[model samples]
Target: MTLDLATLFFVTVFMLGLGGVLLLFAWLQNRSTTALAWWGAAFLFFAPATALFGLRDNLPEFWSIVVCNTIYSLAYGLLWTGARVFEGRRPVFLGMTAGSIVWLLASQFSFFMQSLPLRIVLASTIVLTYCLLFVWELWQGRKEGLMSRWPVMAMVGLHGLFFLVRIPSVTSLPFPIGANSPASPAALIMVFGPLFYAFALVFLLMALTKERAELYQRRAANIDSLTGVANRRGFTELALRVIARSNTDKAPLALLLFDLDNFKGINDRFGHRAGDRVLVVFAKTIQQTLRPLDLVGRLGGEEFVALLPGVTPDITMDIAERIRDSFAAAAREVDGHRVSATVSIGTASATQAGYDFDTLYAVADAALYRAKQKGRNRIEPGRPSLTMVSQALES
Candidate 1:
């Protein structure tokens, strides 16, 4: 193995392509919209690194210059973007990236036209400074957390080292690569080129995939194990946002608070296992009854909340009443014996209550309490159910 620049470039591009494909698949799985930013780096790596040799030598100076200029710039950008994707911000770095781009352009063209010591000096300064910055980024990443992702940090560090060898010497490849490259012992200009970028692409894809998995895991944590609907925390988060936006748009919002009626009796009569079955069945019935804009969540034992955004009071009430009737019709057969279940529902309309989400929840809760007081298996508005009270007084 000659370990030449040509070989390094080829392997580097190949690795970058592989990384891009992996990252694209991972991002697609998560449906992250920002993942498109990776296409810039992936586009450059579609060809093998050795193919870049022809571009460096064959084309005019400007294209060649652009080619090498973007090499480490894209590498660093990938590291930055990966960090941003993981932590929502770029990690710290010690190098001057603007100077490096200027250096790459100067280095590619200096040999073609003239001998410039000042150019060499400036380029070397950029490379060495970037090396120091790479060390700084690694040190900072270790000290202020993110130590667990050292391999990701190392990907950045190696990129700086790529600049170091490529800049000062301007004629050699990195260590431990290009063992059998055709460009090895052949092309001087192809040394230490985009190999580091390939390194970055792979790491970027891996880091992005890891980020998606973590997000999915976090989402799963906020879901109820039994019904697989959003749990109380996720529901509250969704409801607050909906309420805020509904207020802003002057749109209507509705809250539905419902609980199983005599659920304790079901547990005592049929066993808690049967009670759980009823909860699951009741959840399914409500899910089937909801509109696309509606969100349902189990707050805790036997308690549930629903947020209906952009619906009229009549529609919301109708939907709630339908869910109530449907739940009543659902029969659970345990050990060849059929059992019936019912729910107490209380609803509050934001059109009537004004813009406060907490107020809506409170009013809905009060309504639910009213429903329970009047009789189980009935519906109540946030305000007192005067009709039920009137009927009771008449009785």
Candidate 2:
């Protein structure tokens, strides 16, 4: 089979340019994902670099050899920068240009610039370093549980490995002298390999952006923007799963429902901003008081709930009391306003209410009403009666 290097070069340049434009357009539509812009610029840079490399015969050795390789290195470095941005880290401007600087400096030496093997080694090393850095940045954010990240890491990792292998293969195997070298197997592989990779990389980049958008939407739906905790829907979904696990394990669970006292009065007296500060204060207090594994959510305005797994009735009461005390203390002064906020808490246990979220919630809510009736800022226990029924269902 015969291959036309000029045609392939043109195709690569066109495709990379198109991909860069598309990515830049995507970034314009959603300015939050700044990584898209960096990635787009990287692709755009790659187009000119590929052009310079392919047309090396027509251009001066300085532009074709030194400048071309430096641009390629810069593109890879930008890719690493994009990875850092994607993971919410600040881009290291120095690091982004480090590879190109090193390449340009090394190119100053006539012996260094003249040897093809030496040139290939340096170029491949720079690319491999950037690829590895990209992989590491993504790996650091693995806790986010983004499924799209794994494939990106794998692809970048494999690409890095290819470069690593190429460093050794360039010396041992029959390597082509340049891109236009006639249809040698090594030359063909070198020309086509990056073309296919660029295509796949652009596809993955689009997929990654799409995944992040979906994740943000899901979080927006589930999370309470005011308190930085779960909303009612999110809490219910998570609590149901916890209930099922507790039931399967025959372990006890506890639910604490809280209602802020005089919330509306605070808004009326101190202003809505102060009321917001009080809510934020209370949420932070409860979160700090609870165990790490415990789940808490804002059920609605001025009302919040928490679910504690594997907790006894006595422990549940203790936790509820602690939360009540902590919140009262924290909400005493909100943004220089004497808010004097307090909370009434209701406690229910799986031992009494069974492993049903609704049953536990209803019982806790009743207890909360009693706490409010008994002059707020106190904890009340739910009336226990469903033990036998729960055990029967379990059997």
Each prediction's whole-model lDDT (CA): 0.64, 0.88
Which candidate comes out best when scored by lDDT? 2
TM-scores, each model vs. reference? 0.53, 0.94
List candidate 2 stretches off by more than 4 Å: 177-183, 386-395
Q: Residue by residue across 282-327, what tens digits does model 2's lDDT show? A: 8899889988899999989999999999999999998888888888
User: In model 2, which range of ten residues has the least summed lDDT?
Assistant: 174-183
Model 2 TM-score on a 0 to 1 scale: 0.94
- Model 1, 1-395: lDDT tens digits are 34555456666566666656666665576655343345434334434323543456576754544454345444444444444434444533332246545655666665633543343345445545554554454455454433335665565566556546545453333222222223433344343344454555456546644655676678898899998888999998888888889877999888999999988988899888888888888888889888767899999999999998988788878888999999888844643446678899998887766656666777789989989999889998776344533442343
